[model samples]
Target: MHTTPHPPTITTVAVPPGSAIASALPGAYFADSYETTDPDPATSALQAWLSTVAQVPGWTNRLMALRNRLVRLAGLKDLGALGGDAAHPLRDAASYRVGDRVGIFRIRHLADDEVVMGQDDRHLDVQVSLTKRQPPEGPPRVALSTVVHVHNTLGRVYMALVVPFHRRIVRTLLARYAAR
Candidate 1:
């Protein structure tokens, strides 16, 4: 049997700032940005990830639906995250768990500290980093994001669910599976 990485779901709750849940790990991971110079391994990795997830049966429909949303969100040339209505499926499937670790990836903002000779700019370059975080005894996290230009006016939209909420997502998915 093929095992896939699943992120946790989000519930109604108040969490502290800078904390995991408050940082929107799951959503951010899906819509994260990487450096332009970085290796383009995600194209293959993402395909493999989706393939592995789809093999689980029953959940193929749900997994594909989320993948489409991710494609649309990334196809946009804008420089921001992807946003959607509350009823959007992506919002609901934002959380999942493969095993014990809750899949809540972190989005880190990387700034360039160099200066351009001909261009007058303060921050030369800025990028975002994506990393997975696992809870005490949950599924392993998958960290990843796309690269976008910050100067774009369209910006980006993402479902930001903090790290603390990761457990909530995992708990929900697990309960649903357990009920079955």
Candidate 2:
């Protein structure tokens, strides 16, 4: 494996319950780290989408809060490398093959916004859509709403799966860390 830029450390900011803007674009953070370079194409698209969110006033804090939660759950240390490999748990989880099912559920939605993927009782739900127009050409675009939910399996629970799936997808599609 080739060594890449160091992953940005996950910053634990003290966001008051109702202080900052929710859904505040991830671009600010990404720009701060990469000087707005957005190495991954998906991230570039995300930055554009966030720009739309930034236009809204009150929604900022709400969106920021949600983004914070999603980022935390993703197990991603850096928003800079949204597509680059940094140790994703969800992708590995979805790719797991045991017996018949791996206790993961996924759903994919095209022509919509938000790529929703999660592990239900025994399936992975993945949804992909296009809410806003994506950047001209960058990484695979995914909605910021994309997420991975975990479920309890019959005494065979792998919680790490949810975390990594979200991380991989975010860094890959939404953030474009994995974009060529």
Best by TM-score: 2
Q: What ranges in model 1 sit over 4 Å off?
A: 1-11, 16-18, 21-57, 60-66, 69-174, 177-180
Candidate 1 lDDT score at position 121: 15
Give the range of the ten consecutive residues with the poorest summed lDDT in model 2.
Answer: 28-37
Q: Write the per-residue lDDT of candidate 1 for residues 1-180, one digit (tens) a residue.
A: 999744333232222223332343333222221111112223322222222222333443444356456546656322211221233212222232222111112223221211111111121122222223343664433332232232232232222322333233333333332222
Q: Which candidate should be chosen as best, given lDDT against the real structure?
A: 2
- Total colliding residue pairs, candidate 1: 30
Give each model's whole-structure lDDT: 0.28, 0.29
Model 2 Cα shift for residue 118 (angstroms): 7.7
lDDT of 2: 0.29
Off by over 4 Å in 2: 1-130, 133-142, 154-156, 177-180
TM-score of each: 0.21, 0.25
Q: What is the lDDT of residue 31 in candidate 2?
A: 12
